[model samples]
Target: MKFTLVIRQGKTQLIGQLKEIPGVLTQGLTIAEVKENIQDALALYLEDMREDDAEDSNAIIAQEEVEFA
Candidate 1:
């Protein structure tokens, strides 16, 4: 499954967060590294969501579209 990922670079590391998955985030040493880390984090987060008793596990994930004005 593909999801929108937002990445940011810190002084000594790279960070990433999933736009579709709330509270799912991770950090790594490089952009590529952060991408992989975020992917793993997102998988774990989704698994946790599924394991939990929360409803709407099949809810659709949202994505943001960019537009120039």
Candidate 2:
């Protein structure tokens, strides 16, 4: 249920996207707004996927760390 959110300022607005989910993006006038918008979008996307019985290959979130010698 957790996904990486990438936020950036566009020419005239704040843009956001879910790095884990391809093609899932949103934009707003502010960072907070963008975050909220992306959250809503993600929720709707997941809802639709569930309604359609679509399988999510990347449902689980994971992280890895590396050590330098």
Candidate 3:
């Protein structure tokens, strides 16, 4: 899976955020570092989403249905 990175050049560092995922942001001293940090942030973001889903009372794990023709 691929995600877009919106990076901004700051005075002291480069700030970046994943365009598709909200709240996944990081800062680094260089573009290379920012890219690495973004990967970490994306991983953490998805992991957090999974955790949140597990914690939700209304989350659906699976469903079965009969096929009719």
Candidate 4:
């Protein structure tokens, strides 16, 4: 999957983030390193999400709507 990579120049290093996903961010001294870090971060984030989904897959969920005046 392709993600939008946003890069910012920090005080001493380059900061990179996946624009599509919040909290998936990383820093490195060079853009190359930042790109690599972003990929790893995104991978880990997706893995965690998958695990979470698996854990909740068997849950019996219910939804209801409420009206407010």
Candidate 5:
């Protein structure tokens, strides 16, 4: 699967983020490096998500209500 990559100029390095996946972000010194880093970051993110789903399947889910200040 392919997703859009967004790179931004940072002070010391380039920052890259996956457009389709929030919180999947990383930084590298060069464009090539950042591109590579983002790929690894995305892979890790997907793996983590899959693990979470597996755990959720065995979890006893519940809801709670409380006032937020």
Candidate 6:
């Protein structure tokens, strides 16, 4: 998948994040490094999301009784 990165040139490093995904950010010494880091960060982000989804599925109540008093 291709993601747009919003890159910023900082004083000592390059900072970037996926434009569509929040919390997926990273920094590097150069633009190239920043791009690579962004890929890694995005992958980790997706992995975390998958894990979270799995956890949520596990917590689902298969059967529930609605009692109204």
Candidate 2 least-lDDT 10 residues:
54-63
Mind giving the per-residue lDDT tens digits that candidate 1 earns over 23-48? Answer: 89999988888888987897798688
Better of 4 and 5 by TM-score: 5
Tens-digit lDDT track of model 2 for 1-69 = 467899988999988999989678999998889888998898898788666653553654653555545
Candidate 5 Cα lDDT to native? 0.87
Residue pairs in collision within model 4: none
Q: Which of the predicted structures, 1 or 2, would earn the higher TM-score when compared with the native?
A: 2
> What is candidate 3's TM-score against the reference?
0.76
TM-score result, candidate 1: 0.65
Tens-digit lDDT track of model 3 for 38-69: 99988898798778877784867774655645
lDDT of each: 0.79, 0.81, 0.86, 0.86, 0.87, 0.86
TM-score of each: 0.65, 0.65, 0.76, 0.76, 0.76, 0.75
lDDT of 6 at 53: 71
lDDT of 4 by residue, 1-69 (tens): 567899999999999988889779999999999989998998899899878877787773763555655
Weakest 10 consecutive residues of candidate 4 by summed lDDT: 60-69
| lDDT, candidate 5, 1-69, per-residue tens | 567899999999999998988699999999999999998998898799778877887674764555645
lDDT of 6: 0.86
Scored against the true structure, residue 21 in model 5 reaches a CA lDDT of 85
Pairs with steric clashes in candidate 3: none
Q: Could you tell me how far off, in angstroms, the CA of residue 27 lies in candidate 3 after the best superposition? A: 0.8
Please give the distance, in angstroms, between residue 7's alpha carbon in candidate 4 and its true position after superposition. 0.6
Q: Each candidate: RMSD to true structure?
A: 7.9, 8.3, 6.8, 8.2, 9.1, 9.9
